[model samples]
Target chain A: MKARIEADLPFYFGPGRELFGFYHPAPAASGAAVLLCPPLGAEQIRCHRLYRQLAHALAEAGFPVLRFDYYGTGDSAGHGRDVDWTRCLADVATAATELRARSGAQRILAFGTRLGANAALDATDAALAGVVAWDAIADGAALVGELDRMQDALKVDLNRFDQARPELDVRLEWQGFETTEHLRAQLSVVGLPALGPRTAWLVSKGSDAVSEHADRQGRSVEAIDVAPRWDDIDRLEMAILSHPLIDAARRRLREMA
Target chain B: MHEQAFRFGSSRHLVGIVGLPPVIDHGVGVVLLNAGMVYRIGPFRLHVDLARRLNALGYPTLRFDQSTIGDSGAGGKLLARPEQVVADVGEAMDLLHQQTGCRRFVLFGLCSGAQNAHSVAHADPRVVGALFLDGYGHRTLGQRLRHYLPRLMKASVWKQWITRKRAASGPRPPEPAFVVEPLPGKVVGGQLADMLARGLKLDFVYSGGVSRYFNHVRQFRECFGRLADHAGVSVSYFQESDHTYVLRGDRKRLLDHVAQWMGRHFPVTRPG
Candidate 1:
């Protein structure tokens, strides 16, 4: 396969260069940039391929894109146990500034999936032209509850092989990554902030409450049919490649630009 | 430790992260391959953790995705997947050798990655050491007995078996995209013998995740016969850990075991 004209540049940013990200520069400048906020832990992993594709698409459409790992996740410098909602928000703001500098874009739109969408909304950055919240978590407590259920189901599935296996400490972990009680407590109260006029809320068909909430705030809401099964243990290895979602986000971001 | 991300390969489309230690005490760098569709950070970031741990011990490490996976772009569509993977790994070794002055290398992988590592190690002379996690394995008589005997004693197994029999048949689940085709015992034995004869260090770790194919410590010997008895061949059976080392405790145990094995086989000669 032929390489793209604009090759992505991977580098570290943030304090002490602790945060890792890739800068997908637009071949032709649109004066706008997109910052991608990844979901935490395993969700971030499963959606990695999709995110890369999204970044490439956005860049091809003349929007420089910055896809990054929040502190204490992925190739970022901090330990997994240290990750928290507060750190994620701060990282988002830092990444926005970095993206603005790297891409020389005056307007920066943020696109986040799952919990990362929450971070994008919560982050207070003036450079942010808008935010695209895809399957954004409306309730942190509910997300935690779903994660707990998934972990329990995983344990049950594994028990088929070894019945004597001891219960994993769910409070300290969700899936395979390390988590902290502090993080869980912080996540429990997380709610999407009041939507800005430019903010677009993309939800799966079932997330009516989130859609209604966005509509009540007079923000754009698009209900997508193909929701990514990020937490499914059976399809853990399958990468999320929802063309509909990608196209929707691309179209929305183009409109914003 | 310092970690830097860059693109390698002839097209410079393949992305990788190289973890460098404060001091380079060993010439053989470790290359962590992608496990299934999981990216370079590995499932649960096992590779990043392991890379940093190994770096702390002064062994440089590189974790990258092959073409058409993760951040890496596609390779030549003309080449088969296996050939592309082997070619990608050779390019990874070339990058490490050029950047770190490491002439020798140790390849590490999980599941599909393990199979790739084995193949690459067999093909590339620069690969002086290789670690395979849940790699190739065939069911041995002892392994089958150990796996099924406990289930036979459990009433729940029989109950489930009956329940499944009574249930209506539906669509069968699609076969997994990546399956390790077990090599013939003779073929594996001959390959291991050749690698061992070249003074290559080999480590194999089988988790409880692969219990269907491999169970008990002796299964390694049962499957490979006398070749598994080689001093250079180290085998670990984590009957409690799953295929991906999902649990924090299991992952810690694995990381510890890998570090110990690497230290024992490829000691850092210079004082860090």
Candidate 2:
């Protein structure tokens, strides 16, 4: 068995706010730390176990790992409607700082899944040594459009509010979590920007549109086509790990001297 | 209701969250165990919702991961052991007793968690009641007939049988099997009898997904003999719900039912 210490605690990122996270400290100092930014809403619920497994594997491989829920997600402090893409990026930065201070690591890495990947690339700080974007959403407008399609597909009567009534917040509720109008608009404008990290890996389905966009903006990214095992609607209860994606991330982090 | 995160156990590595009501219920609190690989939050945040509802109804609840599961780190052992799970539940109970002066407890769990809760209720005298959701039990001959007979009548089954594309696909890929260990049906029945003999309240809730083994509402009675009709034992079957209660409506129904069951069987009265 691998030797590691897990601390499940909340840290104050704002004056009156606290964010919950799990800190996985490696047995020996690896001089490098990784902050895992998770996807929001139902995706976060589905991937919680896999994310923990990734953190454990990373810690066992001698890297300090910190995986946390954004302000309004998981066991964190806020409600579902309070989360936005901007605040989530700030949460990532706060997590990176905490990981560095706790692990005494000089360099940091940001790894994210889906929309979390978007946040990681957008929130690259000066201390970031590498970035791993796994099946990231390429364009926010397209994502919003897809969400609209999903809402339409549901075709069920809304509990109270309706899209026909423009006065109310045009909310989209997926698997019990709702995205308010303000957050929805913010998400509509999000896309991968040019990143500063030299070491980067982009894992996507068949194509790396986000990385290609980043390349156009002068950021080099090594893209790997690996199909994700995520089903946004269907609840996946199995404890299966994506070997290819994990292996790719492990190999990339290992190469980040 | 308020929630606070904490780590308990000798190593202080087991992580849990305590949901407390406005007033402390010093006599009894509910301890929710992990179901299969699902974390303490449960599928679709069911555990979180259930804890809040229980607390609002005056019963504090503690939901946590075992030594090597969820947010908790590995506990020197690689494979999951039932004995370890049982001991971890005891530690959670001890923590609740120390923090809020809760002496009596109600254990609640689903699937493998239900099995573990059953084992713990039989082993520990402190548990006043236990709720098992989609727990294990043997299928009767009538149950087998009711379950398999429906599949033969499905249009999709006949289509598959005629097309045989599944056969031509060269053996369909193996699904990732659920790894949780199940207690034998006889053993579970015996343990339930023992718990009831000691005056422990028990509730067995089932979903439509377990229809293969538990086809009808009366199957529990048929399988457990006279023990099923015991005053201490209660059984509920939600024929429309899945194993994990994926549907939001189903989850809400489950929460409501569990809360009502607790009110009737394991009501918490705060000590004045």
Candidate 3:
């Protein structure tokens, strides 16, 4: 039985900008509420279907889940040209706020993919009972480098475009988002554990070195190599909805509250 | 986000299994990369056990078969090539990203797996860090010729050719070495320098079993400079630990050091 999806959700946390999201409200009393923050760029695209499925699955299991896009990506708002540091994180807090207000659930769980996971982990003031990252990009620089590596393989160099760098070291905005030296420095020191206290961490490794940081960080990190579907787009959306972990996460969120 | 099967790239099949501690969704993930081949962990269970223990400690882990081996997709040739392994790692990372919305990433592996983790972190600053390298070496063939010249020079050229072919292939590409002494031998100094230049500050602990390759710690000293420069990196050698910490022994110290070091560097948000 399909209830309804609360589309075009709006809320503000940090900068008070009207951020956007899509909410799935279940028919029965919810077990827990989950707010899913998608990774930047293509991960959002690749995991789109998965997140939707996760929302639906959680709803089926008595937990309400909401999946939404960040400031500059997807159909949310703002031109699709954001690369800023602060705005994205603010969006996370906003999403959490929206989930809490709309779902009216006691505890909130933030589930993110890749950069989205990093964003969730970076959030502090938000009242999230538990946080899970499908596979998180702990280092924003690494995600940039992974993309850079792909570009280099394809013979492209974006760093070279920063010619005025020597003249203008001021915070340069790539896309509509500006990255400040301060933000870069803050991000550099960031690890998953920085997400404040009483946080639940999940690092998905298909049994590989990707789990190294999880092992060291001592956060309850696990490697789940489930069938990875979805292409460059809608990957997280689809997995979060249909995957098996949603049930466990829903249970944890309920217990934490 | 438990034990799930997946195919990475076109050739390598990957599995993110529950470790000993079963970190569940919020755990450390380890991606095992075989030197010349991508092997499965379901049957062997060494990597599986490692993943389980880490899982028990709230660390999630994964190990996948590289391209052209096991039941994975087809990943061209040069299976264990640096770039190739990196690509497989990228795929696994993507999978991990899909399964867990983790912000921080760490790597722990052995042999080429360890080397791959180091290189990924070195090139990509985003890597929280890495821990591995049961066998560390630093030497080129030409440099070795000088040291072994007096003896190797006396050997026949035909014998040299055969030895070269065998040595070129990584020892125990698919399995751990049973015997510790009769090591497959390792290159020293120059060669190690060239390969490790790409690694970031990957903090790790090496067991004495890998001592067979290190004639002098100084030979590989240069590699540490770049690592030292990285933001969060540390490394040490556990003179007594083996490749895989034996379950019955006091192996927890090394891994615990890793866990503690992780606690000191990347603090996790404990359930408050």
* Candidate 3: stretches off by over 4 Å: A4-17, A155-190, A194-201, A206-219, A226-242, A245-257, B1-272
Model 3: DockQ vs. true structure = 0.01
The collision pairs in model 2 are none
Off by over 4 Å in 1: A159-161, A164-166, A195-197, B76-78, B161-172, B175-182
Top-TM-score structure, candidate number: 1
Candidate 1 lDDT, A62-133, residue by residue in tens: 899999999889999978898988888899989999998998998989898889888888888535778888
**Model 1, chain B: what is the TM-score?**
0.93
Better of 2 and 3 by TM-score: 2
The candidates' DockQ values read: 0.59, 0.22, 0.01
Model 1 alpha-carbon miss at residue B204, Å: 0.8
lDDT of 2 by residue, A89-116 (tens): 8888888888888889988887888888
True contacts kept of 1: 0.53
* Quality class of the docking in candidate 2, CAPRI style: incorrect
TM-score of chain A of 1: 0.93
Model 2: residue A13 alpha-carbon error in angstroms = 6.5
